[model samples]
Target: MPSVTVRNVPDEVHRAIRVRAAQHGRSIEAEMREILESAVKPQGRVKLGSLLAEVGRKAKLTDEELGTFESVRDKTPARAASFE
Candidate 1:
């Protein structure tokens, strides 16, 4: 895991973060991590599954048509190629 060092944060900001952490019942470090994660990766971000489902709807693909992929899927493991 990687670590980050934030230097020279204003005293007021630090105090506010401490108070927020206490309110949320989380350690200051854990609260900071949650804040950073949400800042970069918010709840409103488009997700892969939602995007694929939207594409399927636009394409008018039926559930039965999608289910056919499972029946026709090849589950065999591929063999390593030999160089002779």
Candidate 2:
């Protein structure tokens, strides 16, 4: 099995990870391995935020242009409810 070394972890973060490992009955190394594995695994759905970002970048959609569309949407008044 390949091994990984994470450096410069903050004291607070290390303490938090240790606490979480204890909560889950895992060693720090096992918790870290679980965390790493979870990160790289497929999430089983589209990530909308990142997909929208990529789309906007590829289509060159500017913030101002998107904002203009939001501001200029049709504001049709609602019709009164009719009872049969």
User: Which clashing pairs does model 2 show?
Assistant: none
Poorly placed runs, candidate 2 (over 4 Å) = 45-84
Give me the candidate number with maximum lDDT: 1
Best by TM-score: 1
lDDT of 1 at 66: 63
lDDT of 2 by residue, 1-84 (tens): 567788999999999999999999999999998988899878886765567667767989999966675576566865779998
lDDT of 1 by residue, 1-84 (tens): 689999999999999999999999999999999899988887788966578668877989989976775477677866779999
Off by over 4 Å in 1: 54-84
Local lDDT at 63 for model 1: 92
As for candidate 1, its clashing pairs are none
Clashes of each: 0, 0
TM-score of each: 0.59, 0.50
Error of 2 at 45 (Å): 6.6
Question: Model 2: how far is 43 from its true place, Å?
Answer: 2.0
